[model samples]
Target chain A: MSLSVRHILSVNDLTKKDCALILKTAQNMEEISERSVKKVPILRGKTILLCFFEPSTRTRTSFEIAAKRLSADAVNISSVGSSLSKGETLLDTAKNLEAMNPDILVVRHAQSGIPHLLAQAVDCPVINAGDGMHEHPTQALLDLMTILKVKKRIAGLHIAIIGDILHSRVALSNIILLKKMGAKVSLAGPASMIPLGIEQFGVPIFYDIRKVIPSADVIMMLRIQREREADSFFPSLREYSRFFGLNKETMKHAKKDVVILHPGPVNRGVEIAPEIADGEHSLILDQVTNGVAVRMALLYLLCGAKK
Target chain B: MAEQKLLMTEAQMDKAIHAMAEKVIEDGLSEAVLVGIKTRGVPLAHWLARRLAQITRKTPKVGELDINLYRDDLSEVAEQPIIHKTDIPFSVDNSGIILVDDVLYTGRTIRAALDALIDFGRPKFVRLAVLVDRGWRELPIQAEYVGLTIKTKIDEVVKVMLEECDGKNEVLLKEHFSKRT
Candidate 1:
């Protein structure tokens, strides 16, 4: 099976068939982590370079682990501050990195389109780890994999995405991916935090979290990205939690089996209550595990050719 | 234009498998686990188990392996190779492991399979079985039990279509350029 595009830059870039194939491949990859000999010779003699321009604990490590598990040599290069706002440095950096001749390039940057720019600069395949307020395609794919592992399907499920919609690449990617896969999506957050003209994407936008609760089979919480804000979007974290945060009380209004998802650095009591973050309904840890499998699938699909 | 030849019909394929089962029974290796290579070998392994059970009054163990990750030409394949499930649930140590496949050609696949199998556990011993052995092996490998031996050109391909996988049990020989979907 083949993905529609060689470089997965955005969820909008993938067809529903592409999404299904990725999830299926990720399922096959999940089995490898269970074996005593977790490493495979699949990506042997291949090199994968993970370039992160932002601080990330899970996504970078997951990609590294996935590359290693497939027996590919992974090298990590990151900077504390490499925001794409710097004009020619982005392309210059990309040219220098690709000169290293890695078989594949996995990139995460504070600015959107860095992965796209690098893909064009480099001869190898490029994977978008995450980019500012634009898309996190792999995270969305892993999120879909985790959802399918539990629900067994994505269609017809009501998935309510709450919080930081204005700054979350995860939310945008999830909304696009889920809607394409036949799931009904609802966006909920403070009016200031929910970006204007996003209803053009056609999902219902709600200011009151209670209105989205009853029918929501899955509640995806987005971290309020303070780093990207020059001026605070919302007045206070306390006020945001009081309204949109998912806790035990909010659980009552949702479907009895409603699952919770957070693209983490969970603000603890801010976006989601700690109990629910660690609860049975949480697919958080599973999402982290599936992240590795999904990255493996992507690397195989893009870079697994010998020629 | 490329040519196609019907090498074995459904009945002929069954009879061939039956003969191979007889060989395994004659060798008293029917108790060994039948571990099939991916795609077609899986069904052949199950078929061998059924015949072994019918003749010996006890079913043998069965497992499936997908050797995509173990292939030497990972970079040579045109399209990306999708990794399939390699589920060998039983312990391979101290148990006889009979590697099964549909056709044995270059023998490189068997070399990869041996590497894949050893990673699971050390088998007491290992053996190979195949439905067809088309000559022109690129590696120093041979099958212990072969149903058919056909001398062929390098450009010809042998395909085994089984009932479970392709809705038929037949073998076809085709010029490699036309390929088989």
Candidate 2:
């Protein structure tokens, strides 16, 4: 079957069939990750370029490793200490890199839609790592993969996304994805942190975290992105933790078999209690492991066309 | 329209698979494992493994290899090729592996499969087994155990249907028909 879709700009860009295809391909990639050799010659001689206009350790490193594991040469270009710091425009930077003839460009930017912009400018396949508050397609895909591994299916499960929805690309992407796959999604966090008109997505919205957790099959604890929020979205971190934080007390309200997910670098004790984050229910680390495989699937599918 | 010609009935296909299994057993490949290249090869591998078990009373290990990533025509074939899972649960190191497939033709798929299989581990020795060996080899690859041989034009398609996947067991050859003026 031909890969009809070219770029992974947003989760919404993919159909349900595309999502199923990706998840299935990711399972194959996971097998490779488990192998002792842990490398494939599929993408031999291909060049993968990672362009992070924003600072990121996990997403960037995962994409780099995914490329390397597939036998592709990976080159990283960050805004800091790069020619961008010397007053080069984003388009100019991307165009110069395109001159180098990379097979795929994986980009993460602070401003939204930069990945889409670069994809439009470049000839190679462009992947959105995380683009501002717009969407993090790969992150959402990885999250879905992890959930599928834990829950066995995405449909008919209640997934509650808690925290920093106003500034979270993960929340937005996951909301679109999980709903498309037939999961019932609910958003819970401080009212100030929840974006207006988000209820139009059709899932129930709750300001009380305790009220939402009891029925949730999965609870995704998002990092309280204080850096992104100019004014305090809540009164303080302590109050936010008191109401929205997933602590042992709040944990009792969740289902016994409920799986806990955190798109990390988690602010321990702020968004989630250390006990809960490190608890048996937590698949945070599994999410990290699945991220590499999911990215590998994306890179393999997209880069094959480029070759 | 391409007209399909039935080459092997359900019972005949079963007999061919049984014969191929008997060949492997008679060759004394007790430590041999069967790895099927994905889609049709997967079911053929499992069926052959079962036949081998029935003959020798010992089941050989079975694995699957998806060569979509290793295909040379990947860029030319489709904008996006559906990737199937390659699951080799056991170690292939130092073990004899019989690569199973439904039909062998241009040998490109076998070459891709070989490239993919070697990446997992270096097998002691590798052999190819197929239900039908269709002519027109584009590469030096050849199947060691063949149930039957068929001559066909380059444009014709050979399809293998298995009860496990396709709800039928048969091989059909469809002759490609160019649009008539």
Candidate 3:
């Protein structure tokens, strides 16, 4: 098989064969991730650049950790400290970075399709960390790894993704992967917050949480709209919590072994009740551990390090 | 070249597995456990447990161990070794353990498997079972119960195909030939 994937721009571009290869590679990478000497010399002479136009903690740190573990030099350029704030177009900034001959470029921007444009402008591989609400491919891959670690299989499973479906790139990417893996997915939230015509993704949509919680093998609660972004989406926090929040009582309807998940900076009682988030079935911390493995796999594959 | 014939058919393999289950029950083994060593061993262990259930009217716990990292020739064989999941839902402490595998050849894989098993917990007694044993022992280890034993030279490969995976049940030996110089 040819090992040539220069850019990872969206989840839709991943085929079932591609998915299997990545998952199998991630399974191998997990062994190296657990060791005390976690660094590898696979990309010892390579350089990876991270250009984040938006603020992030997990996505940025995870990519940096992944690059460093592969023994690759990483450069972090934030818009706040870079010359781009003084009116340099994204293309010009990318062109400048290209001059340094970095082997890989990981970019995150608030505008959708920015990474695709960057990939076109550069000769090296480009990875889209998150491009607006379009897609977050690595996060979705890590989530799949987490699910497989716990459930042992992904097909024929039911996963309920609740809260802020319209604003969450995580939910969008996850729905694509879960459906591709043969899992039945359902979206539950207020009608306004759920995107219209998403049934094309083959996910059933529900406005009531009570009706959907019973059949879920995995309940993934997305972060509620940030307080600053709430004014345009929801009327009040209390009403949203009452309608969609996952509480102890609401969890009883789910399968006994159902796992709870969240992409953090949680809204506490608003998106998911605190009890269930920290409860026995939650694989939240396991997802974080698998994030490193998945990112390592992504970098290795994109860097053509696969054997 | 030597011709290799079928020593055990699919029906005979099933019968031997059931007889092993009866032996496990007659031994008065309690808290019995079956641990398979990665890829092919996992399915064999599951099959043994199913037969054990039919004989004892109780299911023995099953676990899977991946010994990729513990392999003796890991660095020499592949640059990036593949690892599979190791799942043991129940503790192995004081349990009567049966280590299952599809085929036992040079026995180095079983040696690596033994080292991997100790990391989980100490079992009361560890026994070995194989569906087919091709005679070429690099170590002194032997299977307590074997479905069939095939005698072959170093220039042949024994292949076992199971219905659960390959949609058939048979054993074959393919002669290895070097290309003309």
Candidate 4:
């Protein structure tokens, strides 16, 4: 089949076929990772613009690397360093960059649906690196890639996403992708932090981590309460960690071979215990490596490399 | 036995290749690598890479690949007794890889080549180059660097004869008949 992707504004924008193509392409890209001189020239003349309105160390750098590996010239535009400081509107800035005729625009905005709006305005393909608390499609894709590499299949796997569901785009995107891939999903967090209507996504919800930890094949821990304390989302970090964190005692309830995932900048002793994050079941580092592959697949498909 | 009539003469092939080389240079073919899809494509890749080196003052890395295992029709087609050698010495990662082929027929070969190429390393980019794109594609395939696009009927067969195999370089169209019919 021809590989053509116009825009990737949301995780929902991807169909099962698109997902399969990306996964298959990623599998192929993985071989390059094993080689000594890792690189490809599939996008020699293409230009990719990385426009970030928020601060990010991982997503921004990963995308830049991915684009460079594809042989595309990548230009980074952070809100702090760019003309946005001069009071340029998001649309105006986007149009200014669009005038340069970049083949793809990799954008991360603080507001949800900004990437969608930018995609509608520009002729070039737009990739959502992250958008507010709504979704992080690429992160989810990489996470799925990591899971697929480890487990081999997504269908019927019981995955539990623990902590801060209300504020995590990663959590939301993971739930959508996992559910679509036929995995049974469950959310565990403090009742105050879990969104009210999330049950409509067809996954079960739980307030007590102990109740659901045993049945989970994959335990994905979100960043702790203190991570969101800057926004005043939680009152006390210690109390939150005591109740919802993945400690040694709570882990005893989990299956022997349960895989653990965390979207990093991980809180050392807060949401996830150190042992679990660095333990036998940890697939965290693999997720980072897979991020490049998944992004490469996305760029290739978006750039019409499949023909 | 019917005699083989030349479809593309040596002069025509040279002229087309010269034009292709010029376009590659104009399109900034620096840091480019040529990867041929097995058997016939290997010679074409070497030939183009040599030409590109002559023009650019840099010899592009040339790699030969066999995509038999990656073919989509492996399940349908009867197994072949022997497989060809595949050798890609340099990393394709982050480099511009030009996939060279002699003829673009059903596109199944290109599909298999793609699967095989990705197994080595992801190039920074990939583009297709075909000496002859004879129309009868069963899959969606197009050549980015096309030497010629020949329009032919479903029953007609376009044969590519390189000096490495045939005595001279040329392309020929052959007609075949079934004895049972």
Candidate 2, which CAPRI tier?
medium
Which portions of model 4 miss their true places by more than 4 Å? A3-5, A225-231, A305-307, B1-181
Poorest 10 consecutive residues of model 3 chain A by lDDT? Answer: A34-43
After TM-score superposition, the amount by which residue A146's alpha carbon in candidate 3 deviates from its true location, in angstroms, is 0.5
Clashing residue pairs in candidate 1, if any? A305-B75, A306-B75, A306-B76, A307-B75
Model 1 CA lDDT for position A95: 83
lDDT of candidate 1 over B1-181, digit per residue (tens): 6678999998888788888889889998877998999989999999888877888899888999989888888566667766788889799989998999999989998999999888888999999999999989899999998989999888888988899999988999987756333
- Compared with the true structure, what per-residue lDDT tens digits does model 4 show for residues A43-156? 667799999888889888889888877677999999996888999998999999999998899999888899999988888889999898899999999998889888899999
What TM-score, to 2 decimals, does candidate 3 have?
A: 0.66
Which candidate number has the best lDDT? 2
Please state the error at residue B4 of candidate 3 in Å: 20
TM-score of each: 0.93, 0.93, 0.66, 0.68
Model 2 regions lying over 4 Å from their true place? A2-4, A229-231, A304-307, B177-181
For candidate 1, lDDT tens digit of each residue in A208-296? Answer: 99999899989899987777771287777888898988989988888888888888888899889999999989989888888999998
lDDT-superior candidate, 1 or 4:
1
Winner on TM-score between 1 and 4 is 1
* lDDT of model 4, residue B49: 81
Candidate 3 structure quality by residue, lDDT tens digits, A76-168: 999997989899998999999999998889999988899999999988889999888788898899899899988999999999999899888
lDDT (tens digit, per residue) of candidate 3 on B36-79: 87777787788889998887778888888776545666334424
Per-structure clash totals for the candidates: 4, 2, 0, 22
Worst 10-residue lDDT window, candidate 2 chain B: B74-83
Error of 3 at B8 (Å): 27
